[model samples]
Structures are given as C-alpha cells and as structure tokens.
Target: MPSHRAASLLLALSPCLIAQTPASPAPLDGIWLGTLHTGGPSLRIQIHLHQDAAGKWTCSLDSLDQNGVGIPCTLSSATNPIAIDIPAVHAKWSGSLTANTLDGTFTQGADMPLTLERQSTMTKPTPPATPDAALPPADATTIRAILDKDLAAALSSGALAPSTNAGVTIGVLAHGKRTIFTYGTAKPDSVFEIGSISKTFTGLLLAQMVEQKSVQLNEPVRDLLPPGTVAKPASGSEITLLDLSDQHSGLPRMPDNFAPADTTNPYADYDSKLLYADIAHHGVSIAPGAPFGYSNLGVGLLGSALANRANLPYNDLLHQQITGPLNMTDTSVVLSPSMRSRLIQGHDAAHNSARPWDLDALAGAGGIRSTAADMLTYLEAQLHPNQLPATAASTPQGKTLPAAILASHTIHADVPPGMHIALNWFRADATGNFWHNGATGGYSSFALFNPDKDFAFIVLFNTTISDKSFADRLGQHIAQRLAGDPAVSLAN
Candidate 1:
C-alpha cells in the first residue's frame, strides 16, 4: 500500500557527532519543526541545525511518526534559500528562510509542501484514542439495507465515480451467511489489487512455518538467508522473524537504493539480488522490538527468507501454504488467464486510467490481487477454522491449517490508542475487530471482521482517489451499523 501512514518511507538516522560549538549563537541554530501533509495522516518532521566555531553547519532530521531520529543530512547550501539533502533516503529540501521560519517543499518519492518553524522546545505527539461505542448486533437484512443506501448515495455524489467504468464490490459475512453487493461495473469475480493487505497473508505464512517447526519466532533472520548475508543491526541487536512480522525490525518502509526504471510499475525489476544488497548496505538501525514502525522492506525480506528456507519461489510457497488450502483460486501474485480476464481497469485520483503495479521481489509487501468473493471465503475460515476438513493437507511437519490461523491471530504487540497487532492484522482492543487495508497506484481495498459478533466486512475499489479515508470509513460505519449503533454518515 502506498499510503502516507504505512507505505511512506522514512530512514532511521544514526546519531550525529557534533563538533566543538562556538560561544556565539549561529543565526540558524535551533530545532525547526514542520508537518508533511500527506493526503492521509500528517507526519511531523524535525530538523536540528548547529554551527561550529569554524563556520561549518551540520543538520539532522527526525520523523516522529516513524520514530526515526538523529539522521544526519548533508547541507548542500547554507544561504537564504538553503538546500539540504538526505542522500540515504533520496529526499531533499530547499526552503527560503525568513526569520524563524523555513518554508519549502520536501521531495522524496513525491513532492509535498513543508513549512518548518523554529521551536523553543520539542513537541511530543499524543496518539488518538479509538472510539469505544458499544454496538448492538443487527441482522443481515438491516446491514444490507444500510450499506446499499450508502453506496447509492456515494455514487450519486461522485464519491464512487468516474461513473463510466468505475466499480466497487462489497462482501459481508453475518451470522455465518455471506452476502455480496456490487455497484457500477463490478461483479462477484471482479479482481482488484489488494496492496499491503498482502502483508497479512505473509504473516500467516510465517505463523504456519513456526507451527510446523520449520522456523522459530525468535530465530535470527540471517539463518534463513543465503550464507554471508548481513541481517544484524549495527547496534548489535539481532532481528528475528517475529521482529519482522511485528514491524519492529527497524527496517525502512522502502529500501534507500530503490531506483525503479518505471515509476508506474515500480517493483517489477527489484529482484532478490537487489533485496539482499539493500539488507547488506543498510542494516537495521533501531533495536528489534522497539517501537512499531511499519516497514514494507522488513516484511518483503521475511517472505524472501521464508521462500529460501522452503526452496520455492514466493508465489509457489504462498500457494502451498495459504491460498491453496483456502481454495482462494482468484487470490495470487501472478494472475492466471482467468484472473486477468476478470481484472478491472484501475483509475488514479484524477479518474484517469492507471497502470497496475508489479511488486516483483517485494511482492509480499503489497502484491496479491483478489476478488471480494475469494476474500470473504478467506475471512470465513478465520472466523471458524474448525470448519476446515480434518483431512486437509498439513505443512511438512504436520501442522493443520486451523492451528496456523489461530496462531496468526494471537496478539504479539501493542499499537497505541487501544489497539493490538496480531501478526500483520490490526485489532481494536475495545471492539475486538481485526482489520487491514491496502492500496496500490490505482486501487484500494479494506477487510475487517469481528469474530465475537460473527461478522466480517470486505470492500474493494478499482480506483484510487484523493479521499484516502473513504473505504476505511465506510467499513467502520458498516461495522458500527452491524453492532446496531447509529449509522455514521458516509464520507462523500
């Protein structure tokens, strides 16, 4: 998913070594704070500047959301319109200084406006609390009505439009029965890229490997890699398979060396060779099991390492472990002829036709394409694993699919604001709802389920829009409506 929240890349900064300071204060020597207004959640950025007696300037950056601090940066120019570059992350900033403010644009993978204001003291951000509304259970008919009405309204308002080929497929599982709804050109079998939701599947694969005793949660990741592959942090902290699954491996969201030949089809050329080279070049920065920092690179490496251990390609391993047993024929990284035929043409924010992404070696991070029907079947298994036949094929070490599903749901870490992380699935501690969302260049998808209430909601969009919260907000509202809570107005 190329979301500002998870997909946006940020590099961990090594501590900067400051030189001797001059007695006199330098004109631009202070902490400058700013915000990067991503279309989704905003990210706070901190730039620290200092000058030595020799008239030399040094700077460092901190991304508070990513927990990246003290990252040394090159001061390319130090004048009214100062130029600064963070080579390690391929980001640059050029701003005109006026008194205590530096207004400029931050260019990384994308260009975003940034305005830094000198602050007398550093500011600490507080995570928002999750809503704790008690939802009473509603019947299937009620949920269907609410969702149908909302969808119709959204379409009329152009929220779900280009109106020509635009499509949306939604599936809901309530009281052990499944119901699917489609709008515009969507059908039950319409295929769309599920983006970062692929991480949750990768997480399940790791859980199955652990259950089969082929891998240990605490095992060092290097053991699964090719000989001499560097997988240790400079801080002497060993990154474990669990660390990667839980988003605490201290790896960046994307590799610094990533220079895609075609930005539209970004990951197509990134092979294992490049992936391994990236790991060797930029080892983990933060200690394993520190703060939660989402890393596409970390999960992608995990998938690669797991495939290496199994002596199979990533897609092959995925079929052998997950999609195969679940009978999710439409869910796969490499689309079959049937799948390609059912594939929907994705649109960008401008409602213009857009190219689909080929994640290549990083496929585990955001690759799989699936249909709403297939996703609902997968979610149904999660809700009731025992329903799987006992004769179902097990892993090499004889671990059953049911056991692996249960293990994947076990909470391993806490994401603040009353939420828990279970493998790659996020759970609301208050509502006990497990959910994950994904997005690529042209598509967006969201899946959420509550086992206690015996309900699940899945929505797929064949287009990406500026309103990043639309799919998620709609899913949450549907969950609320299922709980018999007052229907929250859908975002137009």
Candidate 2:
C-alpha cells in the first residue's frame, strides 16, 4: 500500500525523580547519564550535546526506560535556564547548566524535577548494527537449504530478478521445533513491512473490542462516525463493523482523496482530515455484504472506528488489546530506533532500492513492521489462543482470546471451492489451514499455520516479488513439508 519509513520511538515518561545523581564536571557537551526515579520503576536518562564546526549547539534525549532513542528537539537559550523542546512527544525540559550538572524540570503532559550529571565516558550503548553477513544460525534445519534452492529457482525464473535485490528470512515450525533460515542480508531480528497482515491484527482488535462490549460488531457504520457525518451506500443499506471486517462494506481499495506527496511511499501524507473528507464525500460502490470484495478502505475504516470507539489511537489500542499481551514487542506501527536499526532495506523486483511506506491515518490497512521472530510468536499465540491472558491486568482488553481467535479464523465467506475468507484471514477449508499474505512496495510476506497438524511457517522477503501467489505457494510448501502431507500443497 505504501513504502516503509523509519520512525523515532516515543518513550513512556512518568513525572517523578527519586534518585540521586553523581556529580561531575565533564562539560554537559558529551553525554549526561542519570536515572529518573519515578513512582514506579527507575528510568535511565541520557542527554547528549554537541557543537558543530559553526559552533551551533545541538542536543537530544534518550529515555532508556521507555526504549526511546535520539528524540529530536530544539534547544532554547544556551546560557542559564536552558530550554529543550521535544514537540514530537509534547515534552520539554528546562534546567540551568552548572559546571558539571544541570538541574531542571521535564514536562510531558506533566512536570517532573530532574538532575543530569555529565558521564565519565561517552559510551552509551548504540542501537544494534546490521548483521555483518546473511547466514542462518548454526542450528538451521534442512529446510534452509531446500528453501534456498526454491528461492534460487524463483530467481532463475526471472520473476524475482525484475524487481528484487533484497533478503529473505524463513522459518518452519514443525513438531514443536523451529528452524530459521536467512538469505541475502538478513538476520533473525531484521524487520520487514507485513502489509495486510496488519488487517489480521485489526480483525483481532475488533474481536477484543466486541468482546469487551465497547463495540458492537453489527452496529451501523453511521453510529460509529462523528455526529452528522455521512457514510452511506447507494442501496440505502446500512454498513456494519462486521461488513468492514468481512470485506463486504463496498468501500474502494483506497480513499479517493489519497494524493500522496510521494507516489513511491504513498500513504505517508494521508491524515485523518483527508480520510474523513473522503468518507464524507464518498458513496458506496456496491450494496453492503452483497459479495466478497476485498477492500483496504473498509478495513482501515474499521480500525479507525474502533479507535474512535475506544478513544485511543489505532497503535495504542493495538498495544493494549493484542501485542502487549502476546509479547509481540517488535510488532508496531512506529519503529523504535532499535527496530529501525534492524530493518532490512527493501528492493524492487528490478533489484533497485525502494523507499519505505509510512502510514498517517490508515495504519490498519498496512502499517505494521515486524520481524520473523516476533511474527512466529504471534502465530504461536494464535495457535494457542487460550494462552492469552483472560483479561489484561491494566486494561479490559483480554478475556476473549479464545472467542476472538475463533471468530477471526471462522469462515465468513467462500472465495471458491478451496479458499474461504474469514476476519481478514483466508482459510483453506479443504486442508484445514488458516493463513494470510501481505505485500508492500518493497516487501512480500507469507504467514500460515495449520492448527490441526500443529504446524506453521512465516516467510518474509525484503523484495517486491510482485507475486503474492508465489509467496503463498512457498508458504504452502513449507506447511506441507512440516505436516508431512503433500496432499495439502497447492499446484504451482
């Protein structure tokens, strides 16, 4: 849907300082390290300062407590009573610089007193560097070599060579053992855009919200929109949240107002204003639930409606509802510096470097970036939905893991004799397999698992293969190899 863009991480901040700092005289010009003693846990704080050749001063904040690094900010008044503005997170810090320490207050929604003392050394840990080479870990399974040969065949076919010069990571989960393989310039932790797999997450979010009774799946779309907003079809039939999740809402693949600043990285500039404007001016292309027509706009609107109902951003709702409980820490709409560092560069099928897509308003359609390791963990949770916490300790976003998982995977529409569509998932009723595939401008990913066979596989490639069917076939092959059932394999 769009290209991937690197993002700065937003660290969670609490307003309290209960720790003492060791005093130093190292000229706040290097790195200042301190601990923010808040009511909860201690947070590691790092402040950096530098002077360019022009003698212009610059500084940044790193809150290790929240895993944020290099938060951009503007400095005010270099002398006494220094002001540091971090508008990205709506935070600001003001303190007076002394010979070796600075004492001031940090304000982010609230104010907390803080003291920073220069560190003895500038050895703060940087984000992990890219892997030196692409090699599977020593414990790789036989599938690595097999998958390599398969990939080589795809490359030889001239299908992948036209627009791909990227890496791939594959995993085969068979008999309770996971064997991971890497090709090109990828590592186990390398991240790729999962594209429409994000819709599966949105589907899960819908299930969680419905289970919590915060949202009614069968309610009218007009009821969820802001008061007086128009979102109606020509048939006069009401669209429901279920319609959106089921891909029967009759919405287009994308909003008509989508005029991207960069076509290569399209969704980056589309915001809520544009999304709403498009919705307000648009009419349904078809009657609701008349047929199975896949619509990214429908799912994106579903996610937006859920966020509106919960009074939270799509990303936050996602964290509280699904990712947090499943411990899919690396899956997120926003990339932390560490996650960004681990991201693999995507390539077109032509083997040219491509820009990454960034989402502004429609993250639910395709805005998630994740790693093979994290995705497998998610698949594991899906396999054992009961393992999800009955209820989130901090939020009312759990307790329906079983029902949600079941509801999401249940067939809602039949695509054909072999394929059936569920809540953002395609189920192979013939083979008892549940899966989904995703692609973006520069990446293609396949995630599939058969619970009955106790098998699953995730294959992520940082190249625009332009053939999701090819990727799906690769995934089916892995699933069959693991399940020892060639009968389940799809014809190539």
Which candidate wins on lDDT? 1
lDDT of 1 by residue, 456-484 (tens): 87889876533323555566667777877
The stretch of ten residues in a row with the least summed lDDT in candidate 2 is 1-10
By TM-score, the best candidate is: 1
Listed in order, each prediction's TM-score against the native is 0.77, 0.66
- Per-candidate local distance difference test: 0.73, 0.66
Q: After superposition, how far is residue 210 of candidate 2 from its true place, in Å?
A: 0.7
Candidate 1 regions with alpha-carbon error over 4 angstroms: 1-113, 116-136, 162-165, 231-235, 284-289, 389-399
Please give, for residues 161-271, the per-residue lDDT of candidate 2 as tens digits: 434455678876654677776766678889899877899999988888777788787787667777766755556667788888877675655576877778678788888
Name the TM-score of candidate 2.
0.66
How well does candidate 1 score on lDDT at residue 102? 77
Clashes of each: 2, 14
